[model samples]
Target: MLFENQRVTPSVSGAGEFMKAALEGAEAIVLAQSSMEELVKVHKICRRRPGMKLLLHLDSMKGLSKTPEAVSFLAGYIKPDALITSSPQAAVEARRHGITSVLRCFAFDEESIDSSLKLIERANPDYVQVVPGVIPVTIRLMRAKTGLPVLAGGLVRTDADVCRAEKAGATGITSSCPDLWQAAYVSRAKRS
Candidate 1:
């Protein structure tokens, strides 16, 4: 997959899974910078991995959104491939620093869909991530409307999930499942 979103887990076990499984073939990975210290840890871990790109997501999950210092703090540590957030103001500022900006509209809704399309048209973000389970129908509809690459995320667990999202107009799926990537690998072997 071109892009994968990874929330930095405090658990050593969880970080192990991300490093070994999800990092294997992914082109880019987004890490949730829930705190200044966490952002440093994630950047250190991901930076050591060759050929994998990184994006620092300023998520509200850990109450980091309210802090303006998060972005500048992270920017000092590493130049991330991009930043992901639901905030338009943050998106605007991120671009000024010569970083790719990604606006995550979380779920697909009429309002969110409409807003995403507009956001894309206005900012011309590198790409957008949408959760289809948020609005399954909107996924198909949005695919037809936008030429920009769409990433299907949120609760993707099986090979069928990856393929279904692809058929619905997503360029690919961003899942934590090694099984789906294994399936893709195995399917490639069968053809060869």
Candidate 2:
């Protein structure tokens, strides 16, 4: 339940996007495609919205070393609630620092899926994020193989895509589209 009851977590790269998502009622957000310099501004925005959960995507971040010390710094200083990374070492380090770790895997074909499963076993992360999440079969396969909550990301442009991912057993979906964010909140409100 990393995102709690929210099914869609906005993937944002800047302070503006973060603020907009927060205003749009996002409970959690993945900070991706961002730089080290932007952390301060994002952290300031986060402090204003203490209830929001922040996740830093290590691979997508610029000028941040993918090392244990870097993970420690992020956990201690930046204070993100979770860490998303493609590196097993980074994921392990995040867990060592008592931060939630999400292992990001790109599943383009059967070979990639098999390899990703092996990586997941070794990383032992808190969650697994499968890229190009439109593939329901891959989502189901990853969930079944890992026995961990799976987050579907990338190419999830429409509500139908979100529905497909959820029906396929995805615990949550991450998207950069603002329209999708509003749609998800509206859908959640309707359900409530």
Candidate 3:
């Protein structure tokens, strides 16, 4: 899985390294590709690669925010096991349509948080991810309200952040920073 800051240009070594970094220590992964075509390529690679669990995130980083073509591209490519989106409305629609949906609560402010919570409760996604900007209390409240798995994301630059979030009830973390997976794997091992 990629992050907001991860590189997305096509290159042999870069692609392999990206896959390796993203998949190596991840128990479950969410590939945030830049475009539909890139997403498809990642899916193919993930299908071929062993071990790491895969979740295709419909993160519209380099593409349109949310469009029919975007939705169709994601739905068609890879038959995603889980779909991630920032909009509660989209998440609800995805769930209504019977996909194992995941939502990223990109709550930059109180209003956004409220909106996201309303959406989360309304749609009841399989997972509700809180971006790194979201506070611990917000994560718990969202979990309590929606009764869904909570994943923390955004600006997670360190392992400590992952552990702290997990301790605070996050089910997982999303980050483009290369060190997170190894750090989290080690942390998970210690806890186990």
RMSD of 3: 5.6
Every model's TM-score? 0.71, 0.94, 0.74
Clashing pairs in 1: none
Residues 81-142, model 1: lDDT tens digits: 77776666666667766667766665545786787778766666665667642344556776
lDDT ranking from best to worst?
2, 3, 1
Give per-model CA RMSD.
4.9, 1.6, 5.6
TM-score of 1: 0.71
Q: Give one digit per residue, the lDDT tens place, for model 3 in 1-192.
A: 222122111111224544765544444556665555565566676687664344556655455455435555555655555667876656665665555677777766689778887777766777777875236776776677677777777766655665566667776666666665453352345453
Instruction: Please give the distance, in angstroms, between residue 173's alpha carbon in candidate 2 and its true position after superposition.
Output: 0.3
- How much is the lDDT of residue 56 in candidate 2? 91
TM-score attained by model 2 = 0.94
What's the number of clashes in each of the models? 0, 0, 2
Q: Tens digit of lDDT per residue, candidate 2, span 1-192?
A: 565467688899988888888777887888999988777788888798767788898888898977888998998898888999988999999999889999999998999999999899989999999998899999999999899999899999887888898899888888888887774442355432
> What value does the lDDT take at residue 189 in candidate 3?
51
What's the distance in Å from true for residue 132, model 2? Answer: 1.0
List the global CA lDDT of all models.
0.55, 0.86, 0.58
